[model samples]
Target: MMSGLSRSCAVGLLAAATLLTATACGSGTADTSAAPGGGKPEVVAAFYPLQWLTEQVGGSDAQVTVLTAPGVEPHDLELGIPQVTEIKSAALTVYVKGVQPAVDDAVDPAKSFDAATAVTTIPAGEHAGEEHAAGEEEHAHEVSYDPHIWLDPSRLATVATKLGERLAAADPAHAQGYRDRAARTAAALGALDQEFAQGLSACRTKTLVTAHEAFGYLADRYRLKQVGITLDPETEPSPTRLSEVAKLARAEGVTTIFTESLVSPKVAEVLASQVGAKTAVLDPLESKPSGDYVSAMRDNLKTLQTALGCTA
Candidate 1:
């Protein structure tokens, strides 16, 4: 997260470098040329999950570039000159609007697709609007609704359908290819959603206490309750909040306290100890996992089954 002055400074620097950095962003995967008429549309994805989905839907017909690199927290991303250029030049940019403030500022409305618009969004977590440390305040989750819609495979399937349409509209030459791939991707996501439904149909506990509130959509999809230690991954919960969650976890018989790779686990570990629960990793898909989206989500399903004592 960036402070007000730092964010303003970043915006000014980005504007200053717009004409200078004509090359593409270099930190992540190979940068695709953002030039016109390559027989493939150049697309920019804001982060990992969006990157994976864009690759799945775009297939070989479109050139996709991801802004956030592997293992980098999306919220903390500060746009470089090249990335700003990439977003401006790309035919389309796929992103969740509230996740990355930098990307939100850089993207063109007419060219970019905000994934949150594709689904019915839930309210932002209780702590979302609260004032935080200087840098954390007014960062991610400042919006009225949560933007982590990709957690629900069903919602992502909807996004796939819409993205395919968007891509087809952008590059009408490969319209059939885009639509076909989108349908296939949607079918695959539907299958994954079914697996989650059946796998978590009968869990021992419905309450989910996580390090952060990134899983709200997933909880909504599967009818589980998410009690997050904090709203933003960058925000630290107060001792009072921790104690409150610990007491609630004990009452709900929560056996696991979930954490993620990008965020520190100290708070989760302490809360787990206080509640006599074990700690487990629950990837929010904010960053690239060891495996791709489908495989990583399947891994999450297995983790949830074990943690929640699901029959499946």
Candidate 2:
């Protein structure tokens, strides 16, 4: 199996190819021809989750495309020339500000498009002040706020609302259509939130040991505890740290070791073997998924319910 970084790079290349092919076939929305009867606006999203959400809000009245593809890690994604061309051609663009810095770098801030909605994450204050400390680093590339904001149902609602409003402004002809879709999507998100609350409410264990700190928002929302994996999301963990985590899991009766989809499961597997626990893959929205936000959260909730042994 490829390491997490290699997998990310491979996925990025695949996305680049797909976008280029679409452009080459003349099937992309970049065509300058006005919409049929000049109806429905065109919107582009930086990644899959946002693309799904835009579709929900825009309904049949809008055309939406996600720059990233399934299984591709969004954090490490780079926009190819074709992808940049797509963004520049869209009527409106929706994206998470900190999650995909490459797209951010490619977009021009000075030019006024029909609309540009970037979801600003909850201040690190929401995460107990971890943001500033993480922000001080001077790297060659721009560091972003944890782009996992969509993991929280409430945050997803906020993002959808903002995107809906932007879409309405861009295409007044479809304002009602966008509004209706947003309402439905928000309601669906609320229902999903209740499922998580009810399903995980009575777990015998509240503390979750995971592959990274990606679960901070989920943990906070559900009032569960989190112990990070040996490695940060970006790098491998040291052997000593892995050993320590295994020891802690054994002592704490951590029945499930949570791994993510984009990362190699070796570290989690090793830890699980040492602790006599099972490993479960929890998605952190680092990659594109086959389904929309609600569907993804449902899968995640089912995994958490099983891992935590929730009674409901």
- TM per prediction: 0.86, 0.77
What residue pairs are clashing in model 1?
A: none
lDDT of all predictions = 0.87, 0.70
Compose the digit string of candidate 1's lDDT tens values, residues 1-312. 899999999999998797445433322222334444354678999999999999999999898989999999998999999789778778889999888888889989998999899889999766522323422455634577888999999999999999999999988878899999999999999999999999999999988899888999999999999998887777777777887888889898999999999999999999998889999999999999999999999999999999999997
| Model 2 spans > 4 angstroms off | 1-39, 109-144, 230-232
Tens digits of per-residue lDDT for model 2, 1-312: 899999999999999999776544343343423543244456777777777778888888887778888777777788889888767667777776656667777665432121123444433322212332343342225333444667777667766776777777777766888888888888887787888888889987887888876776677779888777632456556666677677777777789999888888887898888889999988876566667577778899898888887899
- Model 1 regions lying over 4 Å from their true place: 1-38, 128-137
Per-candidate RMSD vs. true structure? 9.8, 11.4
Model 1 vs truth, CA RMSD = 9.8
Model 2, 263: alpha-carbon shift in Å?
1.7
